[model samples]
Target: MDRRRLTARALAELADVTVVSLSQIKTGKQVPQETTVQRIAGALDYPVAFFHGADVDTLPAAAVSFRSLSSVTQRERKAAIAAGGIAYLVADWLHSKYTLPSPKLIDAGAERDPATAARALRQAWGLGEKPISNLIKLLEAKGIRVFSLAENTKNVDAFSCWRNDEPYIFLNTFKTTERSRFDAAHELGHLILHKHGGSNQGPQAESEANSFASSFLMPRADVLSEMPRVQSLQQILRGKKRWGVSAAALTYRLHKIGLITDWQYRNFNIQLRTDYGSSEPDSMQRETSTLWKMVLDDLWDQKLTRADIATGLNIPHGELENLLFGLTAASDRPPLRNDRPALSVV
Candidate 1:
């Protein structure tokens, strides 16, 4: 029901069963017959074997750091959580085949401020105030599994959560590249600053994540050295490209760091609102997953296609594609030799 976003009545109707029967089965009050299980699986487009598999771990709604929690509907939230469950299966499959990087994130929940936390993470990672060339690659190298969210809606920008000592981030590729980068950084903040608990903190968590993203993407020293005085919107537009952030974000960062006065900040914000209400101008190219590209390429060498992966996971091919959409370097690129050990499973 969660995977298909179906209610009991809807699922029962599709499966040619009564709602009471479905509810009883769901509540463990009655056992479902083999024919009933087959009908339910058929209705949900999942294999019968999928229903018999061991129980899968599911992400709790309170644990997921949703960018816009208030705007997300219950159905949408369920679907997103279901997607995370599927992502766990995919990650497990990858782990069984190849060795992956270990989690390198630090717990920053005790930090006094988001900026300080961001800087600490940067120093720990040995980034040294340099503009990250590819934020997605950086996250993956740090053992953060990055997946694309197929929601394709503005309500769900991105989300992140930790499962079994590993971090996972899901990005909504429907937004501009600049926004997506910020979203990635924002989720990173949640992972470190609120690792134990913060998703339920509401506005406070979101605000800290935003500040962390701004500081992480555009370091205080780097922004000061690059653009000390922002006189006009054009300066912001030109400077934003270096940090891969939106003009509004750059303006806010400048104001926060005292590089720009409150009056100037207000004026610039008004101008930005007039020009680009909810969209970014001159956005950069979206970042793809280098780790996923390498994984797919390695699998390709063993004559395993994406369809094979979906079948192995007992999921639809489209579901796997949705999680990986726009994440690979190319769809038809030839396989390359991988340095990792050979797959343990065919």
Candidate 2:
């Protein structure tokens, strides 16, 4: 509720509780009763079980790279942060159970030019000007944990952070496939170019992330070589599939790289606005978590379920569903309560 910027009085009113009671709950002076919990859950659109467990701390402001503050409300941002914390714990637990990919990125925060940083990372990753087929799969294989945001608010484009020496990226799956792809690269840029750069929320940081994303997705050499002599939106759309980017993104990149004139770029933008509105028309399949999927499948084979994972982590099943983002087939079914106590090696 604090992340939502809801005052105690307002939340109490919404939950049909007294402000003093809510204040007491906040201060840990009093535990919420069952009726209060149900009312609060209904008001917040969260599960009743979520209130039973203690809330987890979100990633620090400086540690996260939001695509834009203007895009999401404080409530949405805080919700994403809270979701990110759960993602981190889930990834951490999965890491212990399986041999996941390790981070292969080097810090490029000192690099002044974002494009240079993007190129350096491409070189480091051995991804020569070749178009990446699947951004999520590549990131997963490279040891960057990626998850889809379950909030469905559509305000958060995407955000990335590093916690406990591991990098995580969360994309708003509610957005277009093209937008989601760009968001993935944008967050990747943050992970590599802004490691430990905390709360990179200014125009400079956003510009850098955009540059990194542009170059990272559409390399200069490869994209330029294939560029059309005449400005053609259709041609670009056909080619965008090769780079797995959106028409608008390719148009901007072309203009940025001097492949197209400013007039042509503006004209293309106008056309995009008319044709696609705020979205692109494509049938690209939404990216799912490969690492988590594998882990869940293995657990299923072993008769261990998402419920088991949730119980082990002391997180609510609803919260776990948000983290898993339908990637886990077993998430739909109720998690079987494990009577065995969680194992701890001291």
Candidate 3:
């Protein structure tokens, strides 16, 4: 069998065989029974026939894929829902412009096992020390289709397609501001790493995505330069322009990369809570959202109304109106929901 991915324990459990028996199979000393093939196939999310007599060369290094999250669990579902509308919008936009390559479908649940995936992603993006901003633009430039789908929009924060050795990216509109940023980076992680099978990302995927988000959104060099020797909101605010992060987020970023002391971080969090409870900080404000405004305006110019967009994306027309009116109203919310969008025409 190919060395795709299978812990000895996981294979044993799936094959319904003893650990010793599973070891023998790995060593090519013995073959398993049909029943064992069934169990292992189910566990690996693969077909039983393949287990019996599949070529190792046909298998990939790892089995990685993402599907629209089905569980109604709030957070997971919300992620899909949030990304659904936006993904539709993005995909449609790409369809209208360039003849994008077919996108590879992905699971929305690859946050698990993100470490190895993260490294693979970094290599793919040709990114290292720099932070990633304007992820939508980056994806578009890569010729991957972006679209919107309202009906089946699973609280999707974002998704990546891996097809023909290329990747495309998508984001959901149902998330919060910070969450959206993180989602874009997360999907970017999938585009770079992972395989094409089931959408299940174990643990390493999550770690890799998180790492990509941190490095992509907040480059380490920028974080170091901005870390205040003396804790001051004013200093932090000044740093935001170059770093392109909110004060609170920047504060956390400082601590994340070991720029700030733990004592300083704790005190800073308290200070921020006291200063800007439930309201965004002045430092967090930006003249424009580089990607958000650009994409929205471009789509609007292409003769796509928010209402028309909603229909194409399978979202409620009224909901589309709400988002355009600067009033995001919906039962399901993404982790990073945004009330502010680009300029709307009519």
Candidate 4:
């Protein structure tokens, strides 16, 4: 159900079984026969061995900090959470083989405002109010396991949560590069501000996260020094590349920091809506996971195909590729020589 995003009724239909029988099997009230099990596996496109693996723990809906919870459907939400579960398994496997960075995030639950919390984190990390060159790489450097949400729906933009001692972030790659970067920072806000204990969902939390992402991505001091006063939408469109954010995001940040007047803000927003509605013009290049790339390269050296990894984890090769920002699909290229030293995760 989790892997294929199928409901009981849907699975029953696919497997040619009655809903009552499927429900009974799911509840452990009745055991499925071998033929039924095979039919179910075939219907879901999962190997039968996948069912025999140890129970995989899924992220509870409550613990996840979804960016647009109000807009996401229940099935989309469930599928996203299930993706997190697969990510956890893959992360564990990577940890066993390599030493990833330790978590450097601070708990800012007590912070009065998201901007202050963002500043504290930046100072702690020695970022010094500069634009983040690569938000995905920075997150991985700080020991955040970043994964791509491969669901075809746009409703689930991004989500983040702490799994035991490790932090994980899932991003929807379907979005424009700039919006995706902001989503990454927004999830970082949830990880930092709501880590200890707080409502990481709902409008208030979403607003705080947006503020944190604004501050974290385009620091107030940096923006002031770079562009003290915004004049036109074209100027904003040009300057937005400096912070790797969309024109809309940069416009909001400028208004929030008083660099732009309310009148200007409203005008720019109207112009932006007119020009590019729900889309970014001249979008930045989408960010991919550096850590996963290095991992795959190392595995390629050992002649370990993505299929092998997926088989070991009891998941489909496509699912593994989906989680990895489609990095594994590149494995179809000519194999590399196994002459390099073992990869040391930095």
Candidate 5:
């Protein structure tokens, strides 16, 4: 239901029932008959048992790092949370069969400064000041379970949480590649810096995440050395590609570091807003889940398919397909190596 972004009204229409009747059945106010259950299962492409599964659990909005919450609607947030639930279930199942990397993030929530926390995380992860070639791969290698959200909603950028003491990130692949990277870094900040957990609002959680993302992507020393005397929008746009970040994000970082004066920053913002708006002039290839790809290959070698896994989980095959996106291994390709370094927690 979340994957398709089907509201009660829409789902009721698809199930050939009235909105009130469907709502009553969903709310447990009335029990659905066998025929009605079959109709709903068919409409949702889910087995009747899936709805009854005790394993069906969802992460709340408060438990996640949600970007642009004001711009996001409640319905969109609910849909994203529900989608995350499906991904979490699939990941939990995969973990039981595969020796996946352990969580590598340390508790950096006590640090008041975002840049300090970012640097600390870099040191702990042994990532120095060098640019991360692929943020998704780096996170996966470090034991962060990344998944793409097919919620079909543009308002949600990305979200992260700690499930079963392991970090999980969900990105909305519908956005531009640059935005997606920033979203990935932002969620990483939440995972590392907000270890204790708090509301997304208050005490500048969003700002801290933004700061951590900027500093993490472009370290202070490296970015300072790269900054030119006369900063221009085009130069920033071109330079942003190296760090896999958006022009606006780089510009803000530059401004925060005092590399660019207020006058120059304001002028650059005017040009960037008028010309680029939300679209990135130059974009990189979309990053998919490395861990998921490897897992799918391992499972495929055993002659098990997504349909088999779906049956084991009591979910529809399409749900698993949507959760995996492009991470599923192709039958024509050989299995991936399982020799990647295993990250550890504590």
Candidate 6:
């Protein structure tokens, strides 16, 4: 509640009490009746005695520590951290119920270091030097729900949230195709690499995710061969179809791999910005979630959907609707009945 910025006066109104009474309670000047306390607790969605406690349970102790220096600005960094923290809390709390399917996430356990993470993921998908043909289909196959966010943001792009142990990534469909692909891959990096290990948001973490996406989407072994001939914008534009990565991502990849000179990278970026790329990803204009396609066949195989999900958990349809959509709330969970397939929650 405190981290969420619920003030005393606001709490009073939520509790249906006078500001004076609220202040009295805050200052320890008066003891509120049991009924009043209950109302306050209900309105605040917290335990009845929470207001008087020094340490609130809503915010975790680990989250209370001071933050590190950010890769972006302090202000934007703070917002990003809050966004991650909120999502993590929501994801954790919501996962307690219902068996969640283990996503086709490749665990880089033996190769836990960064160098191995990329290849581990690539090999896990049977992607031997294969260029990613489509971001939408690839992610959908891995149990990632793709949605287009209406709001446009700067210094920040796409993001994924795990609610009810289900991973959903939202792309800012407003961005150009080139940028959109980068954002999608970046979000996938979040899911694969950072979703678990207490990773925080900021320019630095964002950079880490971005780099992973670039490497994951276009492996150096496969794409570096053409770096010498990638001088003209036409070369990159043509390469975009096969890679499903933006010109920017490819250009950055070239720079990272030392294929293109720093000056060349900067110049090409200028050209890309001037052209502004082309249309958004096919579904971006419509702004819909496409995750249902790839995993549906699997879910059907396992007999899981709204009906099966509700039946397994003993929750109602109306409640299931809320769980499926955002109308109501439910917990996130790891696969409950392991009698079937694979998945994980972090």
Please give the CA lDDT of all the candidate structures.
0.86, 0.78, 0.50, 0.88, 0.79, 0.55
| 151-258 per-residue lDDT for model 6 (tens digits) | 334544556655445666655545666567767777766666655655536665566666777777788787876555667877877666567766666777788888
Cand. 4 TM to true fold: 0.95
Quote the RMSD, in angstroms, for model 2: 5.2
Give all TM-scores, in the order shown: 0.92, 0.85, 0.50, 0.95, 0.87, 0.54
Return the lDDT, model 3, position 127.
63
lDDT-better candidate, 1 vs 6: 1
Number of the candidate with higher lDDT, 1 or 4: 4
- Top model number, TM-score: 4
How do the residues 13-52 of candidate 5 rate in per-residue lDDT, one tens digit apiece?
A: 8989889999898778998888888888889888888877
> Which pairs of residues have clashing backbones in candidate 6?
94-331, 94-332, 95-331, 95-332, 95-333, 99-336, 102-343, 164-332, 322-328
Residue range 1-346, candidate 3, lDDT tens digits = 1122355776677667888987887688988777776776666554454445433221121332233333334444433334433344444444565354344333333444444444444455576645555555555445444332222334444555553454544444544445555566666655554544343264555556656566667766656755536466667666655545556667777787777789988987788789878555653221212333444455554654455555454444453433332322321222232444343333
Q: Give the TM-score of candidate 5.
A: 0.87
**Local error of candidate 1 at 236, Å?**
0.9
Off by over 4 Å in 5: 1-4, 7-13, 16-31, 274-277, 329-346
lDDT score at residue 250, model 3, on the 0-100 scale: 70
Candidate 4 regions exceeding 4 Å error are 334-342
Q: Write the per-residue lDDT of candidate 4 for residues 1-346, one digit (tens) a residue.
A: 8557789999999999999999898788998888999899999988888777777788977889989888988888888898888888898899888998889998888455999999999999999988898999999999899999888888999999888878999999888889899999999999988877578988889999999999999999999999986788889998899999999889988898888999999999999989889788898788999888778878876788788899999888888999999999986554456534356753
User: What TM value does model 3 have?
Assistant: 0.50
**Model 2: worst 10 consecutive residues (lDDT sum):** 337-346
Error of 4 at 216 (Å): 0.3
Better of 2 and 6 by lDDT: 2
